[model samples]
Target: MTSPGRTERLVLPGVLTAEQAAHTVAAIAAEQRPDGAIPWFRGHHLDPWDHVEAAMALDAAGEHTRAEAAYRWLAAHQNSDGSWYAAYADGAADEPTDRGRETNFVAYAAVGVWHHYLATGDDAFLDRMWPTVYAAVEFVLQLQQPGGQIGWKREDPEDGGIDRTEALLTGCSSIHQALRCALAIAEHREEPQPDWELAVGLLGHAIRSHPERFADKSRYSMDWYYPVLGGAVTGAAAKERIEERWDDFVVPGLGVRCVLPNPWVTGGESCELALALWVMGESDRAVEILQWIQHLRAENGLYWTGYVFEDRAVWPEELTTWTAGSLLLAAAALGGDEATTAVFGGERLPVGLEPDCCTQP
Candidate 1:
């Protein structure tokens, strides 16, 4: 278990004290299996993206060994094609509940690996994970559309080969961040990936200037904030983008709504919005957002997935490590945790090259 003092950096006045942060960190650590997989809960399934997020929280709280174990779990379970299935049974090694491979889910390993590297400064670990990251990036770029948007997922053939010819605004934005991290790793190892530079540059262009290429998920708060959070949109444009939808998704003291027309606010979305806000240099607003989501925290130190504001009840009745993870990470950023801040703030990350011919202006 990580010491309570290790989580001192996660202390935020209205959100968490060091003791409270330690409790939350321990709750997540307790759910982690001996093999290092962190499911949504004890009996739930694990998804690649959320698994990485939880591991990142552990790192933020100075749980390096546990974090490294989580990465090892990912490496052990990776498909020969460089992707993991969409869902896996929590306690079983070979039991995948869902066989479809999501582009963003596969790409997210890079973000987590890069974050762990930044947190621990482990060169040998980076070298060991390099091939994994490289393979995953190649798998994701295989799904990129000609217009520079990545197809959200490749459905299982058993599901009748459903034609999923659409891209998601949120997923592509996430992949944008992952691609940058992959390039950073490449640079550190003195191995140049010219193709990745082109891929990331074009993906960023699509995200910033051509939203029409992706599916319309604007009702979801992730679409509203992810481009900015992922570092593809910046400066006055990022601020303007956030302001345009601030009223639509934000539920005042309750936090961010999962979607429009639904009176439900989610801890994960709220924390992610806080992260995007922090990326834009709006730490005050970000901290305020994090403060508002404290209502979702359960007695167990984990958080409920969402609150139905209209029903005035906790919906889903499930506590998620990812929700708590997102909160800790946002708080870590606000608290000046260097690793969390560097990974998300992204000023030091490489921006892949966008050619003159592809310039938006």
Candidate 2:
């Protein structure tokens, strides 16, 4: 854990001082397992995507050694087929509690790897993680639907075999972003993956135009903002998409709601929406959105998962690393850090080839 004023690397400014951001990140760092595994919280579960998000925040804060340890835990635990189990008991990484291998969860490692490489300029580290990134992209693409949408997850063989379920817009959009990072990685290594480019293009088309293939998850905030955040859609179209749902997800003077009718203002969703706004070049609104969530922050710099504004109580009563992670990452983006900005702003990664067959008529 880094004390305030100790990070000589990150240039912290207005929204959160260097001390506050460093302290917030320290709370997340304290939860990293000796084997490098990062659970959601002290007693919560470990999911690959959120674990990688928290690890990326660690990288941004000059905690490179610890960040690599987190990646190493993934490298050490990844299944032979390249995907990790959907969830693991807090620190018991020996086996996943849920054996289902989620495509989005499996694919997120590339985002972390590329972000880390940008932060550190460590070619050897990139070389070391490339196979892990390579295998993960391979695994996620196997479930890509012919229409360009990706199925969510495959049940464990013993329970249901390698069956693909319904696709979720949010998940596919996330995988779209992951594919871009993976392609950038392939580009760096001079390994051509033509199939992946076509897959990305079609996947983007699916997210932008063909909402019919995905489950109706419109009630959730992520399904509203993720396509833009994931680079599947951008520019004026992206602005309109978010503006269309502004009132539905945001709670004035509080934060973004986790779900409608819940009265729960979550830190992660709010920070993510701020991130989306930043990518859309609405930094003013982005800053306002971020400011709305500051009430959710604690003195130690760790953040509560959500608040039941109706009851004036923090509902979950849990301080999640990913919650803290999202805030730090958003701050890094707002502060204009090149690497972190590149990750969130759709700038650093190369967009893959468009598939001829998948475009909407």
Which candidate ranks first by lDDT, i.e. highest?
A: 1
Which candidate leads the pack in TM-score? Answer: 1
- Taking the tens digit of each residue's C-alpha lDDT, what string does model 2 give over 4-41? 66443344333577677777878888888888888887
Model 1: weakest 10-residue lDDT segment is 156-165
Pairs clashing in candidate 1?
A: none
CA lDDT for candidate 1:
0.92
Model 2 — which ten-residue stretch has the worst lDDT?
6-15
TM-scores for the candidates: 0.98, 0.96
Clashing pairs in 2: none
Tell me how many residue pairs clash in candidate 1: 0
Please report, in order, the local distance difference test score of every candidate based on alpha carbons: 0.92, 0.87
Misplaced by over 4 Å in model 1 are 157-163
